[model samples]
Target: MKVFKVVCICTIYVLMIMGTRPTVSLFAHELGASINHIGLITSLFSIIPLLFAIPLGKKIDHLNSKITLLLGGYLGVLGIVLPGFFPNFLGLYLSQLIAGSAQTVLILSAQDYIGRISTKKNRNQYVSWFSFGVAVGTLAGPLFSGIIADLFSFQITFLILAGIGFISCIIIHLVPNEYPIKSKKSPIPTSKTKSTFVDLLKIPSLRLALLFSALILFAKDIYLTFFPLLGLQFGYSNSTIGLLLAINGIASVIIRFYLAPITNRFGTFNVFIGSMIISCVAYIALPFFPQIVIACIIAFILGIGLGIGQPLSISLTIDNAINGRVAEALGIRLTVNRLTQVITPAIFGILANLIGLIYIFLVSSTVIALGTGIAGHNKNNRKTDVMEDSRVKSI
Candidate 1:
């Protein structure tokens, strides 16, 4: 498959997701959601994904990516549209849950499709472009949603997001597949799933990378939910808050363009650790700054760190995957990611509600810093040579 097409398809899916995630938090807030409800609603997005991750990965291993994409597209559209049509707290829950499930399938299919399609020599660059699409979608999604929300209402913003999701669905159908599904030769082809849960645990590097991914995403996901709350506290409009989050996405888009070279020079491991340092400092310091411009600037800085960590972690995970289990390994990675995504908000909401919202960042920074430390000393961090990363893997 051509790299651009895979990237295009993947970008469409992520765009719709990024559009809905942050805006939904604001929508919930308007519905009188307390911090606890917001956290619970935020965490709802990962619940279905957490349960179905591995099974969905196995489906990619045995079945076709095209069908997976189609399913994801439909669910994604349905997920985002629910709140627009219903406009209630229950709507928020359904929207998040379905979108999460859709994302689990869409991501697994795209990553596996790319893994099978790319060569070692070009893998880093190709993946960077793919992730850059994610950055772009992320950049565009909330900013667009915020403007739309301010001009209209959060409910209208939800309709626009639903439209984005539906557009992605249409794009998926129209786009030509670079790697069409393998035609069945006999009754069925043999499915080669690799890396059992126990076997995966035996490898220190892969496990560390997975943990790193989960923690990093946890910080980011929670940041999306909390940043808006923080903004509202300071009396910023929903549109302004969106721009604040969008600054992070914009910085990430810029950084992702240069991420491959950065990875090549510093090694993914080192870059990942550095990202954690930046994120920790930025998140911890965010509590002290109530100014919108300053928060936007800090968001940009935090974006640089996070922007680097995401693709590098994915690369590390892909490089370390077992035979024919790249999708499965990715599935496990997401399982961890979604688990952290699910639990962190659950705890974060209550704690933030009990003490203060600032502590969420404080505790998150500390947790991420600890995870980064573990990753820095990981046994499997030796796979620095991106040119030789074409090993058979599952994730």
Candidate 2:
């Protein structure tokens, strides 16, 4: 129940952040920003997180997470309000960096809070719940922002988002301050072979989970970044573009409610691997459908395809982490996720200028499909181990 409460409060916080996510891209486009400029602004969102996620995770592990939560909340409000006050392209850039950095802390603390409260027995259920809440927030954010941005203006929409973020900050009080589920003491270091990040990289299961999750995120980034531009080219309104984005989120929420059953029937590896394959198809399909309805359909398929990997990644990360530092594992996981967030847009942005916008979706699909192959190999290995262990038990 405490996990539910934390997730509910976080859902509201995430709703504000997700709502604001598209506004930055759309607003910059409105201000005559080129694709490269937009990519720079978007990359700024993850730049700080890529740099600071590990240190921030360490901070959350040692300190009261509520303090971190509060800081993230207030900063979310400040970040939202900044662009409104300045009302320029430059303002949008500054707002994203500030907001993205704040969100990094906010999300990490919320996730760390979840790990602190969850038991191994019920960890998967709670992780799914957290992911479900993220889906809900993601669904609500773009639809609501789209309506407001269209009805009023981007500046007014941002100001309203600021007010909502502040209220979420207030809602943080609802979460109970519980103790860490894992030991808070740091592991004693050994001189013989210092465990480095490379050691973590050596884990086949972790490598599988991290790559699968990050590629899903990368595909979603492409959707969020370029889909609006694609829609606008067809003369769709801001509200329409928002709905297209929301369709993706809506599909994600729908799939997650049934994800447990889905995983049981298909196997976790199959679900993740299958999701990527579907996503690859959907991304390649997006460029051809200029019609809003068609685009929405593609978006829904895209959502369902890409959405499964996230919660599954969380579950797998917990199952696979060698150190039992779920907090640190999550931090490292996030660092990988943010790295994709930072890199893909930058590469695609430059490619858009060099080649064309349509080609980026092809590139996105290729990357996603590549991840599926690697995961498929891991999945086969996992099954073999399970079967062998069962044989040993029978003996």
For every candidate in turn, the CA RMSD to the true structure comes to 5.6, 2.9
User: Model 2: which ten-residue window has the lowest total lDDT?
Assistant: 182-191
Superposed model 1: Cα runs more than 4 Å off? 177-195, 379-395
On lDDT, the candidate that comes out on top is 2
Q: Cα lDDT of model 1 overall?
A: 0.80
Question: What lDDT does each candidate get?
Answer: 0.80, 0.82
**Candidate 1: RMSD to truth:** 5.6
Model 2 whole-model lDDT (C-alpha atoms):
0.82
What is candidate 2's lDDT per residue for 1-395, written digit by digit as tens? 78877788778877888887788888988898998778878888888889888767656776676788788888888988988899997788788889988988888888878777777898888989999999888988889999999999999998888887888787787666755454433344335664445545556777788888788889888888877777777788889888988899999999998899999999887788788888999988899888778888998999998778889998887667653366566677888889999998788888888888888889889988877777677778888999999999999
Residue-level lDDT tens digits of model 1 in 258-278? 886887799766778888899
Best by TM-score: 2
